[model samples]
Target: MIKLLVVDDSPLMRRLLTEIFSAAGDFEVAVARTGAEALDLLTAFAPDVVTLDIHMPGMDGLACLDQIMLIRPCPVVMVSSLTAEGADETLEAMALGAVDFIAKPRGAVSLEIDALAPELVDKVRQAASARISRATRLRERVRARTGGAMARPVPRPRAAQRISVPRGPLPADGLVLVGCSTGGPPALDALLGRLAADFPWPIVVAQHMPASFTGPLARRLDRLCALGVSEVVKATPLHPGQVYIARGDADILITRRAGLLTAIAAPSDPELYWHPSVDRLVSSAMAQVAPESLVGVLMTGMGADGARAMTELRTRGGHTIAESVDTAVVWGMPGALVAADGASVVAPLDRIAGELMALFKA
Candidate 1:
C-alpha cells in the first residue's frame, strides 16, 4: 500500500481528501489538521507522499514545506487555490521542492472536490514514485533564504535584449522547442539559467500548467535567467536570446507572419490530453521550418507528449535531447523518447545546457 499523509487545516478538505484517496484503494492514509501535526506525522507515519494545503492559520504550507525538506525530504504535492496569489505561492513551493500542485476548487467550501479526484489521485501516485534530491532541495532552500548568493550567478542580460523583434526578414538562426511537465519549472530554471546571455536561438517552451500559473512562471523565470522570458499571448516575432513560454490552457504555435518566424497563442486542441501540447508545438514548428534547423528537447514529465513527434524529428535530421533517467524526476517524457530511439543526445539536467550549446556550435 502507498502511504500518504494529507495536511490541511480545513476539516472538510481533510475529510474529502481522505475519502478520495481511500476510495482509490492501495493508499494507507493519514490526516493532519495543521502544519505542527503534519510535522509530527512526518516522522511517526513516514508517509511515502504528502498532500499539503497552501494556507492555514499558523505555520502555513510554505513554512511547513521548508521544514519538511530540511528535516526529512519526501515527495510533496501542494494543494493550491486558483487565484494569482495562489499561483505565486505554488510556484515558490515548487522551487522549494514540491513535486506538483493541484488547484483548489474556487468556492470556499469546495463541495465540488469529487471533480478533482482522478487528478489528485494520479498526482499523488506519481509523487509517491518521484525522486527527491535532498542535497539539491537543501541548496535551493539555502539559496532562497540567502537571496540566491549560494546559487550560481547567471550572466547579466545583454544591452540589447529584445522582447519581440520586428516582423521583417526571418533570421537564419534555428529554434529550440522544449516540452516538460510535472517537475518542469525547476528543471527549466536549471537549464535556462545555464545558457550564456548571448546564446543564439529562440527557445519556446510548452510546460503543462494552468493559465493563471504560466504568467507567473514566465515572470519568475525572467527574473532568474539571463534571457528575457514572456508568455506568448499574441503573434510575436521570434528573436534569439529570448525565451517564449506558452500561455497555459492554450497551445502556442510557430508560424510565418510577414516573412518572419513568430510565436502565436492558439486554442487548445480538444484531441490532445495535455494542454499546451508539445506534439502540436513541435509538429507546427516543423511545418514552418526545415526539420534540420529545429531542435526538440523533452524533459521531466509524466507522459509521452513529445516522444513520437520528437522521434519523427530525429528521423528527419532534427536534433533531439532527452533528459536522462538519472536526473529526471519522473523520466516519463524523456524516457519515452529514449525508448523510441528518438534522442540524438541523452544527458542529465546539469549537462543539458552544455550539450545544447555544443549541438548549436556543431
Candidate 2:
C-alpha cells in the first residue's frame, strides 16, 4: 500500500481528506493538522505523498513546503482556493518542488468536504509514489527568493552558465521536442502562448499527466497559443502549426514510415518505473527523428527519465536544451539533464520561447 500524509490546518479538512483517501485500499492515509505536526509525522512515517493546504494558520503552505524539503522531501500536492493569490501561490509552490496543485471546491456542497471525495481519492491514488528526490527539494529550499510579478519568468543563473550554444545557426529543419510533468500545465500554456502563428516547423511535447487532464490541458493551451494544441489521438499524422500531448497511461512515441512522422500512443504497464516515462519518449524520439532533424528540450519534474535519453540525443549529433533550474517548478528533469552535460543551451523560461522560435527558423 502507498502511504499518504494530508496536511491542513483545519481538523475537518484533515478528516475529510482521510475519509476520501481511505476508500482506496492501496493508500494508507495519515493526517497532520499543521505544518509543524506534519513535519513530525513525516520523519516518523515517511509517507509516499503529501497533500498540503497553502494557507495554514501558523506557517502557511509555502513556508511549510520549504521546511518539509529541508526536513523530509516528498511529493506534494497543493490545495488552495482558486483565487488570483491562490494561482500565484500554486505557481510558487511548483517552482519550489511541489508536484501539482488543486483548486479547493467552493460551494455549499464543498462545505461537506466529502463532496469532493471521489475526485480527491482518485488523484491521491494516481499520485501514489511520486518520484521526488530528496536532494532536489533540498536545493530549492536553500535558494533565496525575490518577489516579482506572477507572469515574469524567474531567472536561473546556474543553468545559464551550464549551457554553451553553438557558434553558428542551427539546421533549417530542426524540430523542437519538449517533455515535462508535475507542474507543466500552466508552464506549458505560458510557453505555447508566446509562439507566433507561423512557427516554421513542428513542436511536440510529452507531459506525464492522466487521461482526464490531457484533453483539458490541450484545450487550455489551444486557447493560449497561436499554434494548434490538442490531445494526441493514436496513429495521428504529425503536422506543423500543431502540437499534441501524450495522454495518461501511455508514453507517446514517434515513428517514421516513408518519411511520414506519426504519433503512437502505447499503453503503459505499471511495471515500468514511470507512467509516462521520459526514457520511452526520448529514446523513441532519438530513433524516429534523424540526428539532423531533431532538437530535444527537457523540462521540470522529478526523476531522471530524460537524463540518459538527452545524452543519447546529444551523442547522435542532435541539439538539446534543458530548462534552467530557477524557472522550473521542480528542477529534477532539467537538473538531471544538466548534470549529465546533455544540454546544448540551458535557458530561463522566458528566453526559451524566443530561442525556440529562432531555432525553428534556422
Candidate with maximal lDDT: 1
TM-score of each: 0.93, 0.63
lDDT of 1 by residue, 325-349 (tens): 8778889999999889888778788
Estimate candidate 1's alpha-carbon lDDT, on a 0 to 1 scale. 0.88
Error of 2 at 163 (Å): 3.2
CA-RMSD of model 2: 8.6
Stretches of model 2 off by over 4 angstroms after superposition: 1-159, 165-168, 269-271
Over 4 Å off, model 1: 108-110, 147-149, 153-172
Put down candidate 2 lDDT per residue, 1-362, tens digits, no spaces: 88898998877777767767777667888888888888899879898889999998988899988887777777788897756566556656865767786557777534756666765665555455455657545544443253222343343343344355453556555466788876676567557767777776677788876555566667656755679987776777777778877876677887876778877788885666565667777778777667657878888666667778877888778777787775676677888998898887888765677667666545
RMSD of each: 6.1, 8.6
Worst 10 residues of 1 by lDDT: 158-167
